[model samples]
Target: MSTPIFPIQQPASIAAAAAILRDGELVAIPTETVYGIAAAPRLQASELLLHRFYDADSWPALPLLLAPEVPLAHLARSNQWAERLRNYFWPGPLTVLLPAIADFPFALPTPCVAKRVPDYAPLWPLLRALGGVLIVGRAAHTGYPPAITAQEVAEQLADDVALILDGGRALFGLPSTVVDCIVSPPRIVQRGIISAPEIMAALQRPAERN
Candidate 1:
């Protein structure tokens, strides 16, 4: 089956994208870091589609990308430490791990849930409008190089995604740094655009004096 495509010219189109997403369909959406394959959070079918597109080893168990302002308590099982981290590094290029909720659609084996609040303001309306957990991650093509431009996304995932919001090349050509906050000493698993020292500084803030 051929995927649908949408050119993201303005905010209004996000509603259209959301409509598509609600139907368990795939959309190649733009973010500050990279284009991502996004689906409505509660829809298992949409999550499965995204997982298959990425060839993710664990289908349905995927990380979620959230709007920065979305209340952490609503979507995550937060503790003092998790709250501190969210307060510090959200709305930027950091993906933190926290405990998962039963409502979460993905099938992540890790006891913690990985979350990202990107810097794209335009994308926030869509995130807020979606109103549930959304499984989003870097939209890279299978077995090929990662995509930095919308054109690359279209070229690579043309056959998979129902919509492609071409907002041009990503400001950052790499994925965000993923840190496992579930552990006592948070560890950096995948280091991307954000550096290790910067993360350590954020984690070791005086407010988080634990």
Candidate 2:
């Protein structure tokens, strides 16, 4: 069960990666922040595979990366602040936690669903082609630094993952800034690349919590 590394520059490779995801297999995909193990969130088999291979803590309330056009209304109970912040910093390393609409077609753990749209160019086409919830997280165990390159991902995950999209090292080499927009005055759950002050400034309001 050797994991295969695919060059994202190749259209065939991208297609193959998408096929693997459609088949409910896990793929290590590159993002601006770090390499993430990506899988189809709706598939039970995929969920099981993700839970079994990824760390337990990593599975709970994991963020699902979506394309820019994936309607945020269905996915989040957003407010003016949340919407403004999303407008300002989406398609980047910012994960927003919003109140989940009941019976939303994803396997999100809590009443809130964490979602984001990465700025990575290589993944856009595959995301457009897949057209479904793709759950992703840093491709490493708990307490380890996030994997940045395909080789790092392969080293950490080994044969557990089905494929790795080699898009070279991550630009930030850091994790995404997690924000709990579910609350009034969005709170910064975890700060990574984006700072709280920056987020507050972008929101054109004061951050009550950090």
Candidate 3:
């Protein structure tokens, strides 16, 4: 199936994009790290649809990516450890896992949820427009080589996602460093642009490899 594409420039276009998201459709928006596939929280079915369409076999079952400022309490039971991590390294390239909320959307089901907030300030209004919808999304570089340009997203995901907003290549050429915040003494699951030394200094602990 061919997917729709849109360029993000005027506010009206972004508003239209939000409407598409609310309707359970997919939109690829720009972020500092990479373009992302976004869907509204209510569109649980879209989550599965995205995975199947994109052939993203490595991702967890419940593939929704939350906005960084999204209240942790909304998705999991919070503790001091979770709070500390959130306070320091959010709105950047870091994904923290937490226990899933029972009433959480079921499109992707893992023991914990992977959440992030890309540091794209201009896109905040778009997120606000979506009203904290649980997005079944991923960096535009999901399957293909990492997208360093908007044209890359257009080339790779044009047929899979409903819309693609060309905000240009991300400053960080890599995906967020994923950390298992759900575990005690949080640990790194995947190392990306953020180096081990930086993460260790932030957490003030030695790296724990499983």
| Candidate number with greatest lDDT | 2
TM-score of each candidate structure, all chains considered together: 0.85, 0.89, 0.82
**Each model's total of backbone clashes:** 8, 0, 4
| Each model's lDDT | 0.71, 0.78, 0.65
Q: Which stretches of candidate 2 lie over 4 Å from their true place?
A: 53-60, 205-210
- Please state the error at residue 170 of candidate 3 in Å: 1.1
lDDT of 1 at 120: 78
- The full ranking of all candidates by lDDT, starting with the best, is 2, 1, 3
After superposing all C-alphas onto the true structure, candidate 3 shows an RMSD in angstroms of 4.5
Per-residue C-alpha lDDT of model 3 across residues 84-190, encoded as one tens digit per residue: 66666667777777777777655344555677766776677777786654464554544565565567767776766677776767787677787777778888887
| Residue 159 lDDT in candidate 1 | 76
Error of 3 at 208 (Å): 23
Q: Which of 2 and 3 is ahead in lDDT?
A: 2
Candidate 1 deviant stretches above 4 angstroms: 1-9, 54-61, 102-111, 208-210
Candidate 1 TM-score over all chains jointly? 0.85
After superposition, candidate 3 runs with Cα above 4 Å error: 1-9, 43-45, 53-57, 61-69, 134-136, 139-143, 205-210
What is the lDDT, from 0 to 100, of the residue 82 in candidate 3?
Answer: 57
